[model samples]
Target: MLDSVRLYLRYVVTSVRSQMQYRASFIMLSFGHFLSTGTEFLGVWALFDRFGSVRGWALPEVAVFYGMVNIAFAISEAAARGFDTFEALIKSGEFDRYLLRPRSTALQVAVREFQIMRIGRLCQGVIALVAGSLAVDVAWTPGRVALLMAAIAGGACLFSGLFVLQATMAFWTTESLEIMNTVTYGGVETAQYPLTLYREWFRHFFTFVIPLACISYFPAQAILGRADVLGSPTWFQWLSPLVGVGFLAVALRVWRFGERHYRSTGS
Candidate 1:
């Protein structure tokens, strides 16, 4: 595992250097990434302008939710960028090229591409996180701070897992990517606010089905010292992020299965 991690780091560094070589295009793409995601904050502001709060969650509170999901997704998107473009690999038969290599296909795909532009999204999330942390009057403690970081880590795992799953689908569905986008990208847009703002059914799907609430909503409530709407126990809130690790595990398992399927069927 240590060697694999070292190899992954080398791949990431090489990818960064390659992107840096195209200085002008790289800068424009980075700016575009920043601007596109930065627009979401405007939507949040617009919502606040019309309604004071969404289900009693104030703007600053929502910012916490926003920041958490954004940072998580940004990290996931950056690391798992290979999965995002997996469809193209399938179409062009480049996935078979990965198969010829000795490394794990999942790791190969993960390191195949890195979306450097998503750094813009990370910046936006950091800005929101800092602003929201200042706006809210939470009496911070060491443990609470640790839990917040854990939750973000968990959220990142959850999202990366989702990306893996999305890519795994290409083993069967090689040409289309629309449906998975709804879950991966749409999930990001939906989770940017407190889950309580949505209906019970939507909450149930996102919570029990995708487990988005486990990564963001429940943990944010715990951080803020608020009563959870869905009756989540305190223990669950603290531990929910670990579910993300599990989610990523499941996705990787599926990816392995997909790889086997591809090998069995490929020429």
Candidate 2:
């Protein structure tokens, strides 16, 4: 496993170096990504400026949510660029090369591409998280800090699962994946706020369905020492990482099923 990880790292570095061959275009694309996501943070700031709070959650609290979601998203997009753009892979017949390899399909698909441009977005997320941490009045504890890191890691896994699921859909049809975007991109947008801010159905969709909030809001409340207005037990907040794991498990199962279908149908 360690050797495999090292090989994957080398594969990613190679891809990054290849992408850097076009230095000017790469820099412009990276800057474009930074500016696009920076506008998202600006939108959040504007919302806070217009309204002191959203559903009683303060600006710093929402920033925590925004930062965590974006951080997870950037990490997933960078590492899982292949699965994230699986439709193109299928269309371009690149997935067939993955099948020819003896390595795990998932790992090969994961390392097939690496979006170095997303480093800009990742940097933005780091800055936002640090600034939000400074702005919030949370009592810092070692356990809480650990939970924050775990939450970010779990969220990244969960979002990667969503990307895999989206890619898996290519086996069936490749018209347009606007519907999956609701879960992938839309989930990111919705999760950047307290889960309790949403209505009952939306909260339930997130908790029992996608569970994006499990990685951010619940763990965040634990870190912030805030009460769960959504009536989730205190222990649920501590155990929220499991939700992301569970989502990933389900998504992987679905992806495997899709692979079987693709192999059988040759589509």
Candidate 3:
């Protein structure tokens, strides 16, 4: 375990140092990432400005939702970038080599690449989180603070599971991965606001199928102590993020099956 940890650290250092060699490129890409996603937030701001609010959910409440999902996605994208590019590894026959390595394939793919530019996304998320915190006026108790952090972590796991699921699909299909973007990227956009505004079926899909709401919405309700919206039970709201871990667990199992299929085919 220590050796694996040390090796992953080496991978991190190597990724950072390589990017440092091209500082100008790194800066430009980071700026581009920040500017692009930041513009999308402006669109959300405009929607609220025009309509005043969606179903009584004011801007501040929406900001909290936005900030939470952003933080989750940023962590996942930054940490699981390699899974984001898993198709490339398969095409280049690199994934096969991974199976022969001492380290776990999942760990190796996770550290296969570190995208330093995701700092821009991380910065944007932090900015929204701070803005939300300032606007919402939640009573910042230690337990609430811990709950918020746990929610963010759970959301990240949910998103990473989506990404891994997307990667796993590549094992069977050689087609474009753009369709999966509908869920991974679309989920980010959808989760950026309260789930109440969405239709009932959409809400159910996110809740039971994808569980995006479980990661942020249901839990946000609990954090805000809101029982009137979806009317989910109080105890369930606090425990909803655990669904994210389940989502990730299922994703890994699918990934393992995909790996086995790939090995059998390669042989």
Candidate 4:
């Protein structure tokens, strides 16, 4: 396992260096990504600007949600770019090369591509988090700080699991991406606001089904010191992030099952 980790890091470094070969293009693309995702938050800001608040939640609180969710997603999208593009590898029969390697196929697929350009979205999330943290009057205790970091890490894992599952689908069929995006990207958009703002069924879907609410909403409530309008206990709030980690573990197990059942495209 330690050796696999080292090899993965080596693969990541090589990928980063290769991408940096065109520094100018990378910088511009990163900026473009920043602008693109930045516009999404702007839309949220516009809603708050006009309505003052949604379900008694102010803009600053929502900003925290926006920030954390985007940060988690950006990390996943960058780290899991290989999984996101796995369908192409399947179509081209490149995945067979991974099967021939001695290392874990999952590790090889993970580092097949690492998107450095996602730093743009990451920067945007940091800005939003800082602005929200400053505007909100929460007494940032050490526990809260730790919770914040845990939430981001857990959320990233959750999103990465989604991407892994997305890739695993390629072993069976290639047409499932659009549906998966509804869970991955759509979850991002939904979790940006307070889950209470949505209908109960939508809230439950994110909470129990995708567990997006576990990594974002429940933890954000604890971080913001707000009561869960849906009445989740405090202990549950603190421990909710582990749900994401668990989800990822399950996704990986599922990936292995898919791998064992995989057949080559025979290209």
Candidate 5:
């Protein structure tokens, strides 16, 4: 485990050094990311300005959800960038090189590239989350704080799972990968708001199926001291972080299946 961590660190350092070769481009790309996601924040603000609240959830409460998801997403995109962009790796035969390595294929794929630029988005997310917490006037208890962090970690894992699942499909065909973006990018957009604001089917899909709500909505309810409207019990809300491990397990299984398929077909 320590050796793997060291290998990943070396890979990250190498990526950062390579990115630094084009300092201007890196700066511009980072700024562009900030600008794009910053616009998302404006949309939330506009919604709050027009309507005092969505359902029973207020703007500040929703910001917590937005911030948590964005932070997790930024971190995931930065760390799991190689998997996130796996279609290119497969197309360019880079994934085949990964197979030649003695280390775990997943680990190799994970550390292949790291996007330092996404730190800009992460900074913005932290700011928004802090502002939201202050705006909502929620009392800070140790448990509440821990749960909030867990929610963010869970959301990160959930999104990372989506990326892995998307990449695993590359073993089959990369022709229609855009469809997978709906779950990845679309889920990010959807989870930014309170899940209760969405329709029953949509909410149910996120909750019971994709389990996006497990990271944000359910935990948010506990943080805000509200009751679940989706028929989930209170204990589940506190246990939302477990969803991350569960999602990763399923995604890994799917990935292994895809790997086996690729080996057999050589496609």
Candidate 6:
């Protein structure tokens, strides 16, 4: 495990250095990421501006959810760029080489690329988190602070799992499916606000099928000290973020199953 972690760190450092060699391109791409996501937040802000609140959730409260998911997803996107582009590896028969390596194939594939440009979206998330936390007037006790960090970590795991699952599908079809985007990118857009704002079926899909709400909505409720209309217990709300970790565990098992059954492209 330690060797794998060290290898991953080396991969990250190499990725950062290579990207930094073209600083101008890196800066512009990062800024583009930030600007695009900023517009999305502006739309959310406009909604709250038009209606003071939606379903009793004010802008500040909702911003917490927005910030957490964005931060989490940005981190996942940066770290899991390899999985996002795994189809290239399969198409070129590069994945066959991974199986021959002494180290874990999943680890090798995961560390194949580490995007550094995602810092822009990450910066935006931090700003939203800090500003929203201040405006929401929540008492930031030690426990609350810990919960906030845990929620972010769990969310990152959840998104990483989604990316792994997306890559795993290539083992069968040799092409990455577009439908998964509905659960991934779509889940990002959906989880950025209160789950209560969505309809029952939509909420159920996210809750049971995707469980995106567990990392953002439920944890945000605990952080905001708000009562859940769905009547989940406070203990459950506090622990919901861990569900992301469990989800990732399940996704990894599925990935292994797919990997074991893989028939190479035979370059």
Reference-based lDDT, each prediction: 0.89, 0.87, 0.87, 0.91, 0.87, 0.89
lDDT of each residue in 1-267, candidate 5, tens digit only? 899999989999999999999999999999899989999999999998899887777888888888888999998888887887888988887778888879878788877789999987998798888999899887889999999889888888888888889899999998989898899889999999988688889988998789999988888889888777766788989998789769977998999899889889986
- Model 1's lDDT to the true fold? 0.89
For model 5, the superposed segments whose C-alpha errors exceed 4 Å read: none
Error of 3 at 131 (Å): 1.1
Q: After superposition, how far is residue 74 of candidate 3 from its true place, in Å?
A: 0.7
**Clashing residue pairs, backbone N/CA/C < 3 A, model 6:** none
**Candidate 4 local lDDT, 114-155, one digit each (tens):** 999999999999999989989997779999999999999999
Cα lDDT of candidate 2 equals 0.87
Instruction: Give the Å shift of residue 188 in candidate 5.
Output: 0.5
TM-score of 2: 0.95
Q: Higher lDDT: candidate 5 or 6? A: 6
- Each model's Cα RMSD: 1.2, 1.5, 1.5, 1.4, 1.5, 1.5
Worst 10 residues of 5 by lDDT: 224-233
Residue 2, model 1: lDDT of: 98
| Per-residue alpha-carbon lDDT of candidate 1 for residues 1-267, written as tens digits (9 for 90 to 100) | 999999999999999999999989988987898899989998998898789876788899888889999999998889988888888898899888888989898899998888787888999998998798789987689988998899889998999999999988888877666789999999999999899888889999998789998889999989999998679899999999998899899999999998899889873
Model 2, span 36-93: residue lDDT tens? 9999989989999999887888888888888888999899889887887788878888
- How well is each residue in 1-267 modelled by candidate 6, as lDDT tens digits? 898899999989998999899999999999999999999899999999999999888999888889999999999999887898898888888887998889877788887888888898998898888899999898999999999998999999999999999999988886438888887898899999999989999999888888999999998888999889988899988999899999989998999888877853433
Using lDDT, give the best candidate's number. Answer: 4
Which scores higher on lDDT, 4 or 6? 4
TM-scores, in order shown?
Answer: 0.97, 0.95, 0.95, 0.97, 0.95, 0.96
> Which residue ranges in model 1 land beyond 4 Å of their true spot?
none
List candidate 6 segments past 4 Å from native. 263-267
Q: Model 3: which residue pairs collide?
A: none
